[model samples]
Target: MVKVKNLTDKEYLYGHKACPGCGLGTIGRLALKILGERTIVALPASCMSTVTTQYPQMNYSVPSLTMAFAGTGAVLTGMSAGLKAQGITDVHVLGLAGDGGTADIGLQALSGAVERGDDFIYICYDNEAYMNTGVQRSSLTPIGANTTNSPSGTASYGEKKPKKNLFEIMIAHRIPYAATASSAYPYDFMNKMEKAKSIRGPRFIHIMCPCPTGWGFASDLTVEIGKLAVETGMWYLAEYENGKVRMNVISKTLKPVEEYLIKQRRFRHLTEDTIKLIREHRDSEWRIIRERWVLSKC
Candidate 1:
């Protein structure tokens, strides 16, 4: 476990322009706090890159690289190889990308890198939509959430498709270490990051980072909304290692899907029937999880 008192006072990521309560910024700061100074951060053309890499006021204290939208994984691979060529093994190569970059266009590059078993850490901070570019929809966007590309009105409901199961996809590649995390659970996220750093080859961590701007929630509600996501079964926390999966946090009884859905404007347009469908879907998914994953006491 990562003790709060033992955490360093130094800020590795700061002086940025992220939203007031941006979960992406919070997760980035926490991740680097765990990874420490010996880390090379890489991000694609996403919210983190846009906010942190602005001219005249850089945010990242550590070495950071901004790559093309579809090249984060590829860049990490090269960074790892370059470090190995120079016989430098202590530094960690970390890649941070948003949902669109990870689950959509960048999937091929990421899959290729993982197949080669490169030594690097890839963290996908999923905000569920293309929040960096006009609130467009991505593969990871949940059903009934309104995006600019998937507007909801009298003519249409919000997004009809379900969110992509990214964790399972990473497991399919047989990654040595992969975990699902939420910004609301910072300590758990930190512990997972520390573990990934300890032993790593194509490690991946999928973090559900709620976007207040895109999700149509008040900035102050970012953390509260994140917690609600897990409480309502819209998101989950788990880890995969050694060909096995384990649940990290399990709720004996889930809060109603409406409790989470009503807070976000994206889901405001959802009718009772649609919400019912979503609840049913969540229940079905949880059933699969209960059957397949090793339930942890935590």
Candidate 2:
């Protein structure tokens, strides 16, 4: 178990231009504290990339590459291979991408890298929409969340599709490690990163990062909103490894889905009927989780 005290005091990621209360910003800093300076990171054309890679002033203290929107996995693979070719093993290769990059455009590249069993860590910080590109809907965007492309109106109801099952999709590849994390739960996320760091093959961590600017929430409420998402079962914490699954934060009873949804401007347009439907879907998902995943007694 990793405590806050166990983390390094050095700031490997800092002085970025991320919006105030940005969950992605917190994730970058905390992840670097865990991964340390001995890492080479690849980022796609997303918010993190735009904010961290200003000319003549890189926010990332470690070696970092700003890759094309769809080339994160490929870049990481090449970096790892090049390092290994040089007999370098002490450094880690990491890919930091947003939902748009991970679940949509970069999916093919990621699939190839994982299939090749590349030694790297790919962390997708999901803000639930194409935030870096004007809040357009992405495949990982949840049902009933209003976006530029999925607006709530007379004939529309925000995004019509459920959030894609990205964790399971990655798990199907049977990578050495995969975990779902939340920005609200730093200890759990840190411990998972530590575990992934010690592993040798493909690793994935999907973090539910709430966006204050994109999600229409107050900046100060970022952590609260993230916690509410988990508490209400809109998101969960779990891991898949060695052909098994474990639920990291299991709750016998979930808070009302409305409690989580109503706070965000994206979901505020949802009516009672839609909220009911959302609750039903959440219940169904939880049933599947409880039946299939090994519940860790936390």
Best by lDDT: 1
Residues 41-149, model 1: lDDT tens digits:
9989999899999987779999999989999889999999999999999999999999999999999999999999999999999999998888999999999999999
Q: Which ten residues in a row have the lowest lDDT in candidate 2?
A: 245-254
> Which residue pairs clash in candidate 2?
none
Error of 2 at 196 (Å): 0.3
Worst 10 residues of 1 by lDDT: 246-255
lDDT of 2 by residue, 1-298 (tens): 7876776889998889988999998898888889998999999999999999989899988999998999998998999999999999999999999999999999999999999999999999999998988999999999899999999999987888889999999999988899999999888899899999989989999999999988999999999999999889999999988999999775677899999998899998998888888888888988998889898854
Off by over 4 Å in 1: none
Structural similarity to truth (TM-score) of each candidate: 0.98, 0.98
Clashing pairs in 1: none
- Per-model lDDT: 0.93, 0.92
